[model samples]
Target: MKILYINAMGPYEAWPQAGVFVSERVAALRKNGVDVTACSYYQINSPAVQRVVTRNGGPDLGTPIAQQAGVTYGIRKIPNGFFSAAMQRFRPNFWEKRIARQVRRDMEESKADLIHLHWIWPMGLGVMRYCRETGVPYVLTCHGGDIYSDMKDMRKRPYILKMLEGAAAVEFVSKALLESAKELGYSGKNAAVVYNGIRTSVFYPARQEHPGKTVVGFAGVMILRKGIDYLPEIFRRIQELIPGEIHFYMIGSGVLREEIEKKMAGLPVDFLGTIPSEKLAERFNEMDILLLPSRQEGYGCVIKEAQACGAVPIGRDVDGIREAVDGFGSLIAYTGDDDAFISAFAEETAAYVSGEKPIDRAAMEAQAARCSWEERQKDSIAIYQRILGKAD
Candidate 1:
């Protein structure tokens, strides 16, 4: 089957994380003998874009776009300048201002059996509009921001409802995400709870000699939504209760780095900055427990990455996160339950590091298994076939 994949910022923006996901899915489809092609919205004209493309070569548009452009997730790729300007000029939802003639022309040029949309916001929304105008069948995969943002805000509500009404199928990364979609006015017959796949070969479990000191770490951007601001409080509480040696590792670079450093001054923390995707596993293996205290999460792929490295995860008990943690690690309250969270963190940390409760290597393997690219693509292909049959 021939597929035309659409992602507006292109793959260059949602790299390693979102970019890697798309690349692996396309590879799996090829391995299964399905032909896939992609059309990206952003121009691959800059050195920044070219460098990442060189690092991670791609006949597939998504992976190269992300690897070179540095877009890790949907939230990171909210284009601010010209892209945003164009969006304002051509309002996709308002029928008076239909999809641009160029987008429709492009879709027609890249004729395929089906169109698979990765994230339905900014660019994905435009692609969907083109598909609708051309009568080409398409599917929308709900990746956090697309669904979660729609539920809380009215601005994107109509567009999301239209997506539900028109899509051949709807996909959510976790069971919680599925529920969130339903709550957000998606009453589609083809709703599916598909977990994102992790490349086990790239993010494999490693046997590490744990230092006597337990290390708690957070990897990813330094941002408010990630709940990095709460780290200092958690660390201070843990220090007061747990008498054993402890260390903290804060990974990744973002706008909030200065604020995080200011809040965590003089604390037992190692700010390793941002490491390349190839080197992230080493940092995961170094941690006794990985903490993700995000206020919102689509599904914490990092938890899966951490679990793959045999690092226990303790995260905030929010939507997709609870699904990710699901007994593999501890989930605590998002707010107002700091004491409870700190206590649970202490228990899980000491238990794993001290070997009081044997880390379930099998469960870790099981979680990683759920995220394989093959499984993700198999479901995607099946959906494509069904949509094509409907077109017939």
Candidate 2:
């Protein structure tokens, strides 16, 4: 079957680490003999677009790139600020017709059996409109921000609900997110919880010998949603409780990097900007624990990545983190309780230092193994086959 995977974020060469799961999924589907292709809207600040903007000294709509994987069409980006938000709120369908026009053209050209839309914000709405007009079936995957953040604005709820209702199937990365969709009045048919998967060959555990101190790590975009502001306080408390030299490796970069670095000064933290996937796996192996205190997460992919590398995951008990750490690691603190979080961190670190809470490396690997890309591919293909009423 021919399947078209539509993503707002393009999985391109410029951003090596971006859309990793999407790339892996497309590759897996192709390997399984499914004719799968990807299409994305040109991200405004993407490396390619930024290069053009830098050369021209202004934003310009450029030609989209066509590759064996799929095509990426350029689209106007809403400017960042209050004005943009207000415009989006007031004129929700401002870009809908344009995006849908492009998507409809692409769909007709590809002659796809089904379309799989990644996020349900602007893209899903447009694609849903196109699909409805042409009587083509499509599945929608609500990846957190679109549902939890975007849909929070009642203005966008009707469109989101309509897209969900019109989908051939709706998939979420976590059960928590699925429930959240239901709570937001998504009474859709063929709803399923399909956890995101990791490429195990690249993320598997590597044995490492620690000479003295245990290292705790955090990997992902260092943003507000990640609860990075709380890291310094938690680390400070953990240090006071544990006598050993504990070090923190912050593995990713974002808008709050400088501020977070300033706040973490005088602490044993190393801001390792951004490491490649292979090196990231090695870094994960070096860590005794991985901290992901996200205030909100669609699914904590880092939790699984760290776990796959045999690092024990310690995260806030919220949304996807709660589910990811269910059988593999420890979940600490009620969400938003700083004091409780500090206490939990202190306890976990103290136990680790004392060798009382040793991580079960084998079990961690096993749990992570269950989340392999091959398995996810099989599950996804099964969903597609079911949607199309065909047998494998």
Q: Which candidate is the best by lDDT?
A: 2
**Across residues 299-341, which tens digit of lDDT does each residue of candidate 1 receive?**
8878888888878898888978887776788787745776666
Considering only N, C-alpha and C atoms within 3 Å, which residue pairs clash in candidate 1?
11-65, 11-66, 12-65, 12-66, 13-71, 14-71, 15-71, 52-68, 197-371, 198-371
Overall lDDT per candidate, in order of appearance: 0.68, 0.76
Error of 2 at 302 (Å): 1.3
Cα lDDT of candidate 1 equals 0.68
TM-score of each: 0.81, 0.87
Model 1 lDDT at residue 285: 73
Provide the lDDT at 346 for model 1: 58
Alpha-carbon error at 80 in model 1, in Å? 7.5
For model 2, the stretches where C-alpha displacement exceeds 4 angstroms are 10-16, 43-87, 390-392
